[model samples]
Target chain A: NAGVTQTPKFRILKIGQSMTLQCTQDMNHNYMYWYRQDPGMGLKLIYYSVGAGITDKGEVPNGYNVSRSTTEDFPLRLELAAPSQTSVYFCASSYLDSSYEQYFGPGTRLTVT
Target chain B: GIQVEQSPPDLILQEGANSTLRCNFSDSVNNLQWFHQNPWGQLINLFYIPSGTKQNGRLSATTVATERYSLLYISSSQTTDSGVYFCAVVSSGGSNYKLTFGKGTLLTVNP
Candidate 1:
C-alpha cells in the first residue's frame, strides 16, 4: 500500500533558513505524528494531527510548526533552522480506532549549519 | 509528561544467545509499544503490548501495567537482531496516542 512516504531523505539548512519536511501515508490513517531523534536518544514528539485540519503541538514543538490539510498529508515546517534542530525526523501514522500501533517513515536526516 | 526508562543501555551478545530488555515508566500508561531500529535506520514495530504477554517467533514481550514496567525477550538472537530497541508508552491521563519513548537499549549481536 506504499504505507508512509517522506520527501528529501536528507537536507542541510543554514541558520535562519526555513524548510518543510513532507510526510504522507496511503493507509488512510486517522492519526499522524512528527518526531525528531538525536544521536543516542529516543524520539521526541514534535507535532501531531488527529485528522485533516487538526494539528497540535507535542512534547518538543518549539521551533517547528505543522499543518494537516488532508488525510494523506502532514507536513512539518522548520521556520528558523537552528543547530539544535539538526536531527533525524520521522513521520508516523496509525488508526486510532483500531491497530493502534504506529507505522514510521524512513526518516529525514537534517543538518543545520 | 510521562517518564520512560530502559535498562542495560548497552549489551553485546554472541549469535544464538538470549537477552532481555526492560522498560519502566514513571506513571500509569494506557498504551505501550516496542520497536527495533535497525542499523539502516528503519523503525520496525515489534509489539504493541500494553499489558500481559505476547510472543512472535523468537521474540516475546511482557508488560505489567500495574507495576508500570515491560520486558522484551529475544531468544536465539542473530546478527540481524543488532540494533537499538525502544519502549514507548502513552500516559493514562493525557493523549492515549502520544507515545513517550525510553532512551532505548542498544543491542549488539556478534557472529
Candidate 2:
C-alpha cells in the first residue's frame, strides 16, 4: 500500500496568495498530521486530526488550516502565504492503537516569496 | 510542552567505525521513534523504540525511559550511513499522537 501520499511535491507562492497541500493515506489510519521543517531544524506541528472531522492546533498553526473530511484525506490550506512560510512540509498518518508510529510521505518543498 | 534534544550536533566517522547518537527528552513520553534523513531528504523510520532495546542489522537502539533518554548505536558504519538522525517523541495521554522532533545529529561516514 502507498502508506501515505502528498500532492504537488514542490510549490512556490507569492505573498498573499493561497494554496492547498493535499495528503492521503490508503492504510485507513485514524490519525493524520501536518508538520513543517525549516532549513537545518526539526519539524514543527501545524495541525493534527484524531479522526475525520476532529482537528486540533499544534505548536505552529498560525498561517495554516486543515480539513479532514474523510479517513483517507487531510488537506492543509495556506490562506495568505508569506515569505515566513517557506519551508518543507510533511504529511503523516498512523493507526489509532499504534501510539503515534507514523508513516510519512515524500515532503512538499514550499517557497513563499 | 516537551523538549527534545539530540547530540553531538555533528559527527564525522571513518568507514567501519562505530558511533553512538543520543537523545534526551525533557518530560515523560508515551512514544518514541528514530528516523534517518538521507541526502535526498526523505525521512525513513529506523525504529519505534519507546523503551528497552531493539536491534536491526548494524544498528541498535536503547531507550531508558526512567532516565528520559535514548541511545542509537551504529556499528561498522558505511558511507551510505551518512545522513541526519532524528529522535521524535509524543507526550503521554491524548497528546500522544503529536510528535516533537529533535534538531537531529548529522552523521558523515568517510570511506
Candidate 3:
C-alpha cells in the first residue's frame, strides 16, 4: 500500500489567502489526523476524524478546518492564512484507536507571509 | 490535558555509540509511541509500546505505565540514526484518542 499521502509538499501563501491541504490513505484506516510541527518542536494535532462525516477539534485547531467525506480522504482547510500558521503539516492514519500504530505522510511545509 | 516531557533535548555522539532517550508523562496513559523524524522531515514509527518492553534490531523500548515513564535505547547507532526522537501518549479515560507529544530529543551522530 502507498500508506498515507499528502499533496503540495511545499506551499507559500500570502496573508489572508486560503488553501486546502489534502490527505489520503490507501490503508483504509478508520481514524485519520492532521498535525502541525514547528521548527525544533514535536507535532500538535490540529484536527481528526474517527470516520466519515465525523470530525473533531484537537489541541491547536484554530485557523484550520477539516472534513472527512470518505474513509480514505481527510482534508484540512485554512481560511485566512497568517504567519503564525507557518509550519510543517503531517497526515496520519490508524486502523483503530490510539492503541493501534499510526502511519504518517511525508509532510507538507507551508509558509505564510 | 496531559503533559509529556522528553529528556536531553540535544545529544551529539560518534558513530557506533549507544544512547538512551527518555519520556515522562504527568498522567496515566493508555497508549504510548516513539517516532523518529529524519532530517528530510519524514516521521517514522519506531515502536508502539504502552507498557512492557519491545526490541527491534538495534533499537529497544520499555515503558513502565505505573511510573508513567518510557525509555528508548539505540545500540551501535549509525549516522542514519541522527534526527529527532519524539514520544507521544494518549491519556487514560479520554474519549478522543489524540496523542500528546513531547518536544523531542535531538540526536546527532557523526561519522
Candidate 4:
C-alpha cells in the first residue's frame, strides 16, 4: 500500500549545511508527523500537520521546519544543521484522529559533523 | 504535559518463552498504540489498540484506559521480536493531538 515513504535514507552534512528530508504517504492520510529518535531515546515529535495548510509545533521543533502543502506530502527542512541534530528521523501518517494507529516510514539516518 | 512510563527498561528472553510488557500513563487518554522498531531502525506498527484486548498471531495487547495502563503480551518469543517496543498515548482533550511516547522497553529474544 506504500503506507509512507521517506527519501535520503542516509545522509551526512557538515555544520551549517541545510537539507530537507522528504516524506510522502499514499494512504490518503490527513495527518502527518515528523519525529527524531536519538540513540537510547524514544522518538520525539518535531512538527506535525492535521491537514494541508494546517501545521503546528510538537515536542522538539527547534532547528527544523515543515510544510504540508499537499495531503500526500510533508517535508522537513533542517536549517544550519548542527551535530546535535544528527539522529534517525522518521515520518508517519494516520488515517483517523490521533486515537488511531499511525503508519511510519523506514526512517532517515543523518550525521552532521 | 502528560507522562508515560514503560517497565522493565531492558529484557532478555529465550526463544519460545513468554513475556509481558507494561505501559503506564499519568492521565486518561483517548487512544494508545504499540510499535516495534527493528534493528535496522524501521518502525513497525504492532497494535492500534486504544482499549480492550486484541490478538494477532502470537502477540496480544490490552489497555485499560480507566486505569491509565496497558499491557502487551508476546508468546512463543522469536528472534525477530528482538527490538524496541514503544507505547504512545493521545490524551482526551483535543488541545493536543500529538502522541506522547514512553522511553520504551528493549527486548532481546535469543534463539
Scored against the true structure, residue B50 in model 1 reaches a CA lDDT of 82
Please write out the lDDT profile of model 1 over residues B20-66, one tens digit for every residue. 99999999877799999999888999999989999999999999999
| Candidate 2 regions with alpha-carbon error over 4 angstroms | B93-96
For every model in order, the fraction of real contacts preserved is: 0.72, 0.69, 0.78, 0.67
Give DockQ for candidates 1 onward, in order: 0.66, 0.72, 0.74, 0.69
**How high is each candidate's interface RMSD, in Å?**
1.9, 1.4, 1.5, 1.6
Between which residue pairs do clashes occur in model 1?
A: none
Tens digit of per-residue lDDT, candidate 2, span A1-113: 98899999999899999999999999999999999999999888899999999999988999899999999999999999999999999999998995678889999999998
Residue range with the least summed lDDT across 10 consecutive positions in model 1 chain B: B90-99
Which 10 successive residues of model 2 chain A have the least lDDT summed?
A94-103
Error of 3 at B6 (Å): 0.6
- What is the lDDT of every predicted structure here? 0.93, 0.94, 0.94, 0.91
**DockQ metric, candidate 2:** 0.72
Q: What's the TM-score of every candidate structure?
A: 0.96, 0.97, 0.97, 0.97
**Residue range with the least summed lDDT across 10 consecutive positions in model 1 chain A:** A94-103
Put down candidate 2 lDDT per residue, B1-111, tens digits, no spaces. 888999999999999999999999988888899999998889999999999999999999999999999999999999999999999999774453789999999999999
Tens digits of lDDT, candidate 4, B19-100? 9999999988877999998998898888888789999999999999888899999999999999999999877764647778
Q: Decide which is better by lDDT, 1 or 3.
A: 3
The C-alpha stretches of model 3 lying farther than 4 A from their native spots are none
lDDT of 1 by residue, A4-51 (tens): 999989999999999999999999999999999999999988999999
DockQ, Cα level, model 3: 0.74
